[model samples]
Target: MNLLLNLILQEKQRIDYMLERYQEELAELPKGTIAEKKVNGKTYFYLKYRDGRKVVSQYVSKRNLEDLQKKLEKRKHIEAMIQSLEEEKRIAVKVLEG
Candidate 1:
């Protein structure tokens, strides 16, 4: 019971962090993967993502790749945190039940 309670608190904290980031820090970030293609010895970048069932691509300049990468990494981190919180919640519930 003690362990479960602690786990619950930890999960709550993480969820709060995720929400705060999503609302303030990363609110304007578009969802996509940074994809690169090379043509005849030159490299070009694009932000690739899915729209329903179709794969859409948005062009990105070389100068913007670094910023895009940072946003992508931050988005991934937030997603991982949300997943972790969900798992923790499930485990805590099971522990309390059994």
Candidate 2:
């Protein structure tokens, strides 16, 4: 049971590390230019840039950012849940032995 708990802890740490990497990558993206477009009767965000030829990223609106945030939160929540379950299992093993 101790061994199992240790493995679960390691997995949680790995996911946390990956999440940090993703956040850093997102932060490094250029601000570029902002444009508004109506799609499906809702305004959406678009980022445009020029090097030699113009470049545009697909719409990345506030709603999209919020959705990403929610996903990250869910990932973290799962990691925490795994850790909690591992602890619970360890405790149960101890109780049964006693």
Highest TM-score among the candidates is held by which one?
1
Instruction: Tell me model 2's lDDT, rounded to 2 decimals.
Output: 0.60
Candidate 2, 12-67: lDDT as tens digits: 56656665665555455454455678879988766555666857575676866665
Best by lDDT: 1
- TM-score for each prediction? 0.68, 0.35
Candidate 1 residue-wise lDDT, 14-61, digit = tens: 766665665565457678898889999999999999999999999999
lDDT, residue 53, candidate 1: 98
Evaluate all candidate structures by whole-model CA lDDT and list the values in order.
0.77, 0.60
- True-structure RMSD for candidate 1: 3.7
Model 2 spans > 4 angstroms off:
1-63
Error (Å) of candidate 2 at residue 36 is: 20
